[model samples]
Target: MIPTKLIPRTAEASEPPLLIKSLLAQSLKYEPQREIVYRDLFRMNYVEFNQRVRRLANVLAELGVKPGDTVAVLDWDSHRYLECFFGVTSAGAILHTVNVRLSPAQILYTMNHAEDKVVLIHEDFLPILTAIKDQLTTVDKFVVLSDKVYGETAPDVLSGIADYFSGEYEALLKEASSDYDFPDFDENTWATTFYTTGTTGNPKGVYFSHRQLFMHTMGLLTYIIGYEAMPFKGSTDVYMPITPMFHVHAWGFPFLATMMSAKQVYPGRYEPELLLKLLIKEGVTLSHCVPTILNMLVSSPAAQKFRDNLSRWKVLIGGSALTKGLAQAATDLGITVMSGYGMSETAPVMAVGYLNEQEQQLPKEDQLELRTRAGRISPFIEMRLMDDEGNFVPHDGHSLGEIVARGPWLTQGYYNDPERGAELWKGGWLHTGDVASISPDYWVMIADRTKDVIKTGGEWVSSLDMENILSQVEGVAESAVIGLPDARWGERPHALIVQKPGYNLTAEAIKSGLKDQVERGELHKWYVPDRILFVPEIPKTSVGKIDKKRIRSEMKEQILTS
Candidate 1:
């Protein structure tokens, strides 16, 4: 647990503190020759990267981006995006990341909700902004992010903007101040804001303070050190964040890279084929993305060509549970896959499945199992599972409860949305809404989501458990379990399955295959899915998560029609 001391002590006169500005200052000192590579551009040293960031800050100030004002970036993961990550924070502005996958309506809702003053959007996403421009309330200027992808902006895309600027983002760095004093930024000042995917309701905005982000960056150093087998050198490694920049700060990789002076690689638009090619050509040592993205990479026909490169890659999987099947497939092809868990509220990194000194002695199989569960909490995070009454659950591997967490990095409240914020921080704990069980070793097995758990005959059934088991079937590629409306019981399990290509499957066959578990007491009779529907594809949310809400909605429509 972190001490109650909220303020970090200032370093002695001879030494500076480990703030982001100091980190950049020091990187230029030691790693001056290290390369920082993006998809279409590259810089050879920290001096270049640092200067560019400072220039961006100066440009932002010139454009009337005041302290504490929200500056939203709607762009792909590019060199400019990474620069904005540091430049925006250094300028004392909050960087709000708009998920490009969101529909125009949702994009408008989030922008209006955050009160973003300036939107720095990629020229490619212009169509989306055009659709929602009439609905936005807070945007005062439009700064277009130009790249090689869109050589020149379309005439209609640039129309009706209050102020618009286009050209290279790196140019701002050259023309602006190289040595202006960084503000005496308060740690509590907002650094970044992100909108939740909003499965249950409209997307809610959550922002993190500079102190929280700084702490998270420091904590991840241990996690990278644990990746020694496929080592990452602050100089030698090239990073391409497969995760979107807007999503949990791309799981804090950008912050960690800046702190450690690591070279970065950005995959502008994630095409598994393109990513695979970049992984090999660039010799990427460290990367972070969700399981589904890796699924596409490994399953892609191009995977075999990059066999040598795949074995040397180190990956951290989060955003959703990574099943054993996906892990094994990655492992078989030489990829090191580790599970990490966090919510949109926890600056999003609570635990990573990196082996500590003690766990190094565990057998390979034991280590893999440990890596599969959300590994133990990081040094800065405190986590516990508590029952509905708030009593702590024993870490006996069988006792189950909702997982709750509190840490400096956790969100204090939803941005200006008091009612939802209260619900998020109820009982003084950041409610994860994830139900799980913990082992004596402190590993967490998330059994089901609180809202997704099926209650039948006054007992709970873990949809995750059923889905995990079903996904292991030879013909099933992916599976989702959701509670369907039932008359006899409050709710019953219904399975939505996607089968592997060329495999014939039926609901009866799938049900019979799972019956052995009930006979063996691995599962109870009531836990089985009452109906199994085979679909060509499983519906996924913008973030590549199973869309159970959509499934349930479709099922309801089917029921009404019948």
Candidate 2:
């Protein structure tokens, strides 16, 4: 280690701990009047939101929550959920944002694994809790979250679990005192915990420290708002998160938006119509989501009707690769769309699309190509590509390697799993498991997931590349590519496609389209799928990513038989 001089600190100097409450305090100081809307149900300004957050902290304390305890919340994107984001962590308890889309068994496993002491569950998710209430060993209390009044009686789902009920969310907050001192602690304390939507076995738990989250928020603000040529977000922009808050804190936007004091809208559950309505009604200028949600919104009839209203909207696409076809579709509708890249363990944002001065002057088609890539890495992130032999791959934009990263905000390791955690951080760098080539200028173009890349005839074929090509084909609504086991080639590319309504697409037409790509040198001839199966829908993971694992398992026998 290089020796460095240390500065002497005065005894009276104060070093404030970087905590979630600090973000809330900034919002309170700057934009106390800015509103937070929850699905047309509740609307409150920052001052009131702060009171509610404080009340929630008090409520947790009254329910016997102690420092280092876990509080799990199962709800849609709502004001209540936002309150929990600040409140639970401010009180020195870890907030577990349960993925409500998981199956009952998985939900039970995650809640129990987190060792939840208090659960604040939405009425919509009560059935899920009801299914696993008997099996939960650590939960000490349950608080209901709902839009409508339960009146004198609780929902039928909570019939047998009345004793566990503390009270409803709003009622408890209303009853509790809105004054609580949020004490300062070590900045490295675990603040939030959530499990990844793993394709195999159980979802691994990942937690973030208050310091990590604070640094992530600052880094994102610097890159996204302060540095980008066409910034996706601003303090003046009205924000709505199309992504589920349960997933990586909606890619950590809630905290950033709060720190910026931007007006926020939370759609209850993602109904495309409702989302569009909120987009129109709230004048939502900035948002983020996976490509699947964007496809759903653009495909909806309401999108066309409200096309003019969406002209000012800017969306950052992540959770999966953003295809050129999807980006063009949104662009055609006058929506600004860009791609970002990160995973559940990365605090979900390591890189995002950024157009430099020269790149901004490029032609539309060239710009779209650049915008759909993973783009340049964010500030404070040290990223490099590493090969199988543990050698560093050059950033020449042609060498392929697995993307490994080290950053202040990246999860140190998986929660409570020392064995797997060691593997995750093997070389002191967090392995991202994404295969990509980085341009000399630092732009990242993702090829495919490490496990999802297809090996055919000794050549590596990127499923994501094939999917992106297929997405641009006429009449194709959605597509997914997987490697099918074969005797001759070892593995062959196979595709499942969902066609756009009113268009009948055949395998021959799709193959012809791939032939065009091959001729243009955009794809290899071997990259064409041996079989194309038109399907009603492609299975997606709980977080709306293409469930290629499920697809591969389901299609293997079917393709072999066929």
Candidate 3:
């Protein structure tokens, strides 16, 4: 450690700080001519992209945005949101990526909580804004982002809020000069913030600094480029992000793609047919999304229509675990599917299930094993599991413990909430709250969230493990397993399974299949759920992970009473 007396020296000559703007600047230098495509409606090369970014910055400055001011945006994964990522932050203001999927009450809370001074709304989301219009206290200006899929004309839907609207995104940029000096600031200043998907109560805020996001971008690139076998190709690959742009900056792909000058396609308000069309038409090679979105794509008629185009695509599944059944379906379609693990608290890319050279040589059937685990932890993240008593959980491939991580890119804490923040950063590690184990070779496999583990007769069983197995049942479309109260055993599992159309899977048939797997030693007798219910659909959170909390509350008495 250095001497304390020398630590506070602003006079230090060699302190080279990292900046987020550097990512854009570096991209502009080399691939300024690379294409940035927006759903066939808008297209621009990096040189023009830079001009748009600067113009957006000038517009914000004209609207009285200053350093440290919070500018919030409510839009889909579009080119405009991409501009805000750089322009707002480059101008030294904080970008609040508001989750438009939240209830109107939640949206009102988040905007006011962030004290957002300016709001950028997509024309589609205008009604949502007006519905909560009077409740918005901190928003001073609203810039409407056009939602025209294939036209230059703005939507006429803003008449309801004409008094609330400030200007249109295109017109404002057109009026502003493309020359504004974005002053450099300490990279530790806040850059972006968004609320967690929030299963429990009110949504909590998570934030990242410029340095943190830049470091995350570097960490992500380190593995994506370093691991040549990563599902998504680098630089030359066509990139699309099915994850909402407001969700962890679409897991930071926009920044990484911009930095690489990769061809980017933004499919606004993702429709299965439209996304499939763009996937083939634009030759999109890589994208990331939750499993539900992928399930939607593969289940659509568009998938069959564009079957030949599926082989060229690669997808990273996160926000929830990827089921083996889903992996098999993707494999059959010739789409490369892999699992990734992280939370909203992480700059959200911690690990990706990528095979190494040796592992890649294995048969395709065996490779799916590697493709389904939480995956190898990415570069620069220190991860390990700890037991219930806070002792080290040995990496023996069987011991389970809560997954915790420490990294340069991990959030410092929940923004402005010190109590939860301290708990999150407890024991000097950013507690991931996910339970997982590591193989001897260091491949990480997340079993379940800490709270979701099932305990029966003093034995811990993974709820995720059961759901993963049940998902493979022929007629099952999706599954959710929850440990319910049992007087005989502490808690036994109850499962809710959604069936595919034209298939009626009875509870006995499902149990019989599970029993066969148990006999084959693939599952434990206790691991078999005590009860299974076929449902039309399983409830899901906003970002499309299973909503067990809601299910447990809704079905507990019925299951117990039965």
Best by lDDT: 2
Q: How many residue pairs clash (N, CA or C atoms closer than 3 angstroms) in each of the candidate models, in the order given?
A: 1, 0, 0
Compose the digit string of candidate 1's lDDT tens values, residues 1-562.
8778565756763433334565555666666666666664444467777877878888888778998888999998887888888888877888898888888898899899888888888878888887778778888777777664343543334665534444345445556786656766567778899898766678988888887888887777665555442246776677778888889899887887876777777888888887887788778878988877887788787887778778778888888777777777788789988888897788788887757678879886677677678766676677889999989888899998999888867889998889999988888988898999987776778888898999987889988777767867887777788998789999999888887778999998878867887898877887678888888787878777788889989977876787
Give, for candidate 3, the lowest lDDT window spanning 10 residues. 227-236
**173-194: candidate 3 lDDT, tens digit per residue:** 9889999777778889899999
Show where candidate 1 strays beyond 4 Å.
1-18, 40-44, 149-157, 160-177, 226-236, 356-366, 560-562
lDDT of 2 by residue, 327-347 (tens): 999999999988888998989
Error of 1 at 43 (Å): 5.1
Cα error, residue 161 of model 3, in Å, equals 3.0
Best by TM-score: 2
- Per-model RMSD to reference: 3.3, 1.6, 2.2
**Residue 149 CA displacement from its true place in model 2, Å:** 3.4
lDDT of 3: 0.86
170: Cα error in model 3, Å: 0.6
Where does the lowest 10-residue lDDT sum fall in candidate 2?
149-158
